[model samples]
Target chain A: MAKEKSSTKPESPAESSGHGGGGKSGGEVNVFDHLELLSAMGRDFASSLDIEASLKRAIEHITNYVNAEGGALFMLDDEGETLRCHASVGPVEIIGLTLEADQGIVGRCVQSNASEFIRDVSKDKAFHGGVDEETGFTTRSILCAPMSVKDERIGAIELINKRGGDGLFADSDLHLLEAMSASAAMAIINARMAEALVEQERLARELELAAEIQRSLLPEPGGEDYPVVGVNHPARTVSGDFYDFFPLDDGRICFNLGDVSGKGMNAALLMAKTASLYRCLGKTVRTPGRLMARVNTEICETATRGMFVTLAGGIYDPKTGIIRLANAGHEPPLFHRPDGEFQDFPAEAPPVGITPILADGDEFPEIELHLDGGTLYIFTDGVTEGYLEDGSELEVEGFKTLIRDNAAQDTATRLDAVISLIKRGDTALRDDLTLLAIDDAKGHAARQAGESPEPVSVDIEAAAVEEELLLSLTVPSRADRLKTIRNAVTEAAKLCGLGKDPAHDVVLAVDEACQNIIRHAYGGSPNGKIKLKICRTEGELIILLRDFAETIDVSKVKPRELDDVKPGGLGTHFIREVMDETYFLDPPVDGGNLLRMIKRL
Target chain B: MNHEIKEDGGAVIVALEGDVDLQSSPDARKVLLECVGRKMPVLVDLSGVGYIDSSGVASLVESLQSARKTGSNLILVAVSEGARRVLELARLDKVFTICDTVEDGIAQVRP
Candidate 1:
């Protein structure tokens, strides 16, 4: 169409070239008119937000220049099975017309990426007359050009019935349409790319806001001392699994864990809804089964697209050592006996959001269990389905072994150890992991009567971030006050990479030294005061003990012989056995003694 | 310190709780001596002991000697972590008759 290429300056078609001075040749368009058409298409196809409207205008201008009665721009659907008219200008409104990609003239052009010129439509086998028969438009000649770039076939453009010429499309008309279709194809692809970028940014922002709402809906983490402990590690920025526990007025704790079906924003939104329903309805509805029914009723009315939530809920009384629980299609919660026995309770009803009411009369089935110095473990399938260190799935048995391995530790440590086991550093988590442990508080209390306080769980991440910590305390040298000193020392030792046996040994050594201050320093008098200062710097613990009593003979302090089989001097032996260095320091005041101890981490 | 004295299978079981140091070891010694006076068998459960000092160990040693004089068995059941370490420091673990559980302690005493 353009023998004269695009120039630096804009020029009128007649002045831009003189090729058409001989006035039009047989069945070909005027060179000046063709130049005008090409220039117009170039200017019109750029910078358009409404792609369909712009294409409609471009097709209208092309039909006029080609002197055709009508033209339609057909585009292939996503699946490429059919062609639909995206833009059309004709005597009949075939704008939204559709045809199978293998059945019509336009379809053939799109499939083959070639242009077609039908001089007479009556004899053309590729032409379908369905639109003509339905719209009462007369059959005539047709021109179809493939709208493609390289090998990609976007669609095809069709024009019919040349308007004042011999009522047929010519070679020049095919050339003009093919050139324009290529430009249109490129414009459509660019416009689609721009649209997709915009849509992606919008969805990202929406997902971020929804994730924030989900985090806000979550509850605070339970500490080691709390009998009920829960932990969650999300596979993605948002999770479909959630758990919560809160104390009730009647000295009982209510807890629940749930997993919503599906993934992405839809699943996350449903999870938030189900979690809120339980937190609100779990308070007044004492019976776990009745609470589940109310939650199910609310979910059934609102949850769409066949989404559902599997959940388990229970109320535990610390005084009575009993729990009343209800399960709804969740993984069976495991009850581990103190005797190393495991019993599983399976779900008896379907998950919520399937129906409004339960099939078994009114509520989900509930179980009453007594925790006799044992613990109940509730977790999602993510833990079992997680990959182990050897790359095999941590089936139910593997997960139970993780629990049993750390069962000798307290409840919080058991959960941490299990989480650290299945946690992967080289690959993303296959699913979200959520677990909860309900301890038998009353049973343990009856056995642990005047025992010292339990140690709190260490925050390993925080310990890594902080390299130094100082613990200072001053208390009377009394036997009852020794436990407080032991707890503080244990935490410091754990932070310095000394835990389990090594940490216990450090605590015992300190306890023995403090006992000497009460017995020997004060000479069995309760009137003396004691001070302790512990500091960890660069992975080394330095302990200082200050006593306000008569100074002892340092050289004479010794452990009794093993053959003696006595007890009073074992304190001195324990201190020498555990600490890397132990010596007496000069007292800061005149009337006291300072003992220095150091343990290399 | 607090303790519970129960007779199971002809063995006097004395379960001690809390820290047994200089201040509380005297009470533990009195209880152990009373159980030994029964002269059948004595099982001291150290499972509930949090922090037992040298004086507490001395009380156990005195009770064991008294128990031997009467020809009655003196056993330790469920010894706690802290108590076990203290016993091992002076090779007392080799000297004492220790069992893993109360059932084992009762079995050994009866047999």
Candidate 2:
């Protein structure tokens, strides 16, 4: 009962004045009535923080205080171009309606930022009859006032047809409405500001989660003996640029870098898709051009609107010192010769996802370079377009100069020099940055010589054979164990009277095969073990690798098109390229795979 | 890895030091992702870094993807030797914008 009275107390002023009868009384009594009304209205305004509910209560009070037949509160939209009727009373449902800010008396009050009183609405040129047409309400006189906070006009409130016999709205009525409108305007602004802050906080949390998922898709760095590296710096939480590298069975490294157009989640998703496609297809396809074509077609089929990928990739054969490259609308890669000359291999084909299919004959064109002992630098445009503090771009020429200056340095130092030159000023990057450096085998040897010596422990077990078993050993599926495994295999091959070239090929093939088992079959699990057995027959050398890991579908294990131009799946391609014959056996009942390869001596 | 974030204009500049490897990449990832969530341009300073492994590179890549989603930019400033080598070997130097200093990174973002 107390709650009900407290709520109704604010309405007592309107009931006591007999609906606009306050104007009939003299000045002192009218002033006293208004004072009571102002206090009551202030209590109602403080009752709720919700703008719509509080505005509705305020309008109801205004209509009763002024003895109006109808009243409406309009609010300005964000653009401040139009007024929307937010709350209404005593007439048709005009709530949720819109009007031009300059349309009627309410608009006039808003424009002038002052209260208005009309003795006869029919005589006023500013009176608009659209509401009457819609609501079937006749207006005799009207009172309107602008709603503002801190001198900024937000909207206005209007009351129509004073209810007394005179049917006229007085100046006092306009003044009361003006006071209430000011308070309402401040409440509305406060509510909206609060909502915006909450929304900002929600969005920030979602983006962080998205970034975590994207991070897991990238491969680990610094495992390859090929002296390769890649960096992707996003302007946001996730990046649309990606790069990947994997060793082929033939001691070569297949690597690729790509950029998806636009930024954010969509681009990141597309980038992951494109990278995976390249990796899956690159395994089957040995030719860089053919591999890129297949990846381009796949991207075109799946990419969303306004999305595409620019890719530059290649296969670097460490033995022959040859690099086969394919570019798809990506920046030209720089080839730095040992003699200090730079060669640019620019794009010859369009970016992927732009067309349904690449041009038939010239699809991603391939470029081949024989680097004796030089270094091949493949990169995206981030390097060439890096900005300095002066706002000048590090153009291709500047990139070349940096490369030339650092050409004599080791691969790591050379790459560091180039990046440092681009990062010489205090500025943020405008795009993702990526670079790949492939040095000749001699360079690999040079880098390796600086590394600390590893402890050598050989445990070779011999199985009965006609003459002798070359070598047999078992090691854990770990990257560090690879060197010891390779050395033992080479020594065994040498004892079998194999020439240096054949011995080298045997060593490479065995190393690549073990790498595949460790990386793919064992999934890099340190606990997984691989057994290597090499035996020389009367006319052939046979090698077998056995692993206890999940079995792969041998039938599905084929290299993608050579033009796929991505990384991964190249282990099989390498195995096929280096060995005379290779076979992947079905898993044994206990769950393990055996890979066998043969080379005619 | 250790990092500090500062606001410059409408962007956030993160200064990173120490080796960013498998062991420390998670920490780097957290700081970078937080900066990206602000939906403003980000600049990572790697001058104080001595080494960065694949996981470190992956963290930065993830940040780039997040920035793109939020319509912000992520840039690298003052790349160090180890970070540069890993980035170059993976061919990411061409994909990310490298700047010489934080001021340059801020200028690029604002411009």
Candidate 3:
């Protein structure tokens, strides 16, 4: 291939009319005739916004116009530091090749930003023989031009081995190739610009979607009966603490405020899962204690144990003026009374999903508050535990005072005052602060004034539906029969809801209730058969379960206190939360345990 | 919106049955592009349409791009009350010549 270089260098201009611009001296064309042809070529090349196709077409033009054997175009790498081959017309194998500065004729054009006409390759010290060796073709005379836009040299184009010719590549050939390279350079620049614009647009779309997912995870502000005020201020685009609320049957509203262990996407995901789990159980579970127990067991089974969630949930019964609440290892909730005094509800048990199970005889404290004309404030640690300018944590007591002082005003004013107090001596909230305030005064007033409105009944029974597995049983009306059925339903539902076991948690809760009634209430009494009714909703499973046991205990049962740590006698605790409703009704002839269990589907 | 067109040996027709405002313009555009890109002379039926907006006009223009690409034609039929007001507001009533009835629109597209 190197020996053919000497044969292509044409020694005389007289025999090379077709090789250069000298053939255009006939004077039949206009002054800008060459410019017009070049402009037309530029327009044709630049019209296409496609990078790969534009480069390929430019390479073809370089080979045909310059009368060379083949040509290759090399561009700067993404970082714009190294020259990588972009297009080649003649040699298929050498297309998309790479060359470094100071390497070959292509490198010299890129480094010097000048055109080079080499008539003989073996005599030129800068010539590299790799292309010749790969193509097995003669590298005779060569015309190389710098591919630059303005003063910036992006790459170089090299036309190798002039076809049907001998002698050095003329000056006019260099001029024509140089003009072609200018347009090629502009095409390369335009393509790169378009690619960058496309990349930026894609990133913006992804960010918008991420923002949407984050917004969807948050609970809606306020509710139908409960005028709730929810505020979540994330330190970044997303935060770890999440709060959610969903309606419950029998005029109860189930809501939870939770704090995940960390922040960012992982914590956001965990927050979503935790909120969903709490919402699911809140719909199924009847009371706070039972809800915490079911949630604790499920979280322990599925969630990372070390990374637990501190959640406080309550079912507000506007009809009875009673709020049944159970807390799992979270900040103590603050209650601001009409008398301008602050009382903190204690979170007597560890956070749910961390412990394996509620121990027998362990007291699960359930707080039954008769909400009067006052406000209930639920917040994350970000509000009180935040550092002040003096580097002091506000603590629970300080937050309580703040709420008590501000509760007399409108809800918005009260919230603003509370936040202002927290940020009094600080510039910004150091962590994400979440505050939820619900006004109970209006409902309380309506009830106290002897104008009783109908309770906001969200019937979960309407949504109870089951598809995968069904458990149906009819046992005799014996005291033991009720206990056995309760135990079976509760166990089934819990295992089913827990991700790993795949057994339904609602079914298991029902089973536990049956077993408790059988062992304690009937005590081997002679009675007819009992019935357990289980159904599923679109998002929950409802158990219209009933059992006949004459001695079913209704009143003297001690509700599980949160401080007790034993496990065996938690049947009542589980029943209260796992089943949406549990009522001991008197039979048409005799009293019996009439329990209803609802589990999220 | 109603569309009818006759080009070469084929015909195309489009029919709309609801408000063709900004809210429903995306659906209108998708359906119109389908008719034009198929190289069928087109007819658009706007007998039941209650409204149209500038967004609807833009979608119709997009159909023109596809019609030109496939070498077909598009014609509108039975302009409604609210739709005609929008087309008049945009001065597009002059741009797109209208046919009074579905039969007239179809005849305009017949070879």
lDDT of 3 at A139: 81
Q: What's the C-alpha lDDT at position A193 in model 3?
A: 83
- In the predicted model 1, the residue pairs found to clash are none
Best by TM-score: 2
Give the per-residue lDDT digits (tens) of candidate 1, residues B1-111: 899999999899999999887567778888999999998899999999977877788889989998998888799999999889888875799899999999999999996
Instruction: Give the CA lDDT, 0 to 100, for residue A390 in model 3.
Output: 72
lDDT tens readout by residue for model 1, A544-573: 787878777443243332223246566777
How many angstroms is the interface RMSD of candidate 2?
A: 11.0
Query: Which DockQ-derived CAPRI band holds candidate 2?
Result: incorrect
Can you list each candidate's DockQ? 0.16, 0.01, 0.01
Residue-level lDDT tens digits of model 3 in A1-601: 1112213534323124542333235343422434544665677666775667766766775465455668888887766667788788775447656777657888887888888888888999998888678767778877889989878778887887776545556566677678878888887788778888999898777755765786787777664445566777765556778777666645557777888877766676677777777777666566667666777777778887567788887777565566767677788888777676777886778776567656533334678777787777889998888775578887777777666666567776777776766565436667777777766787787878867643322222322233433455678745334335545655556644644222323433454455455444554334545566565445666565454556443432432221121123344544564455665432323445555555554
Interface RMSD of each: 6.1, 11.0, 30.2
lDDT of 2 by residue, A496-569 (tens): 78886566656656766876666567655789988888887888788878887877534233322222212244
Candidate 1 vs 3: which has more lDDT? 1
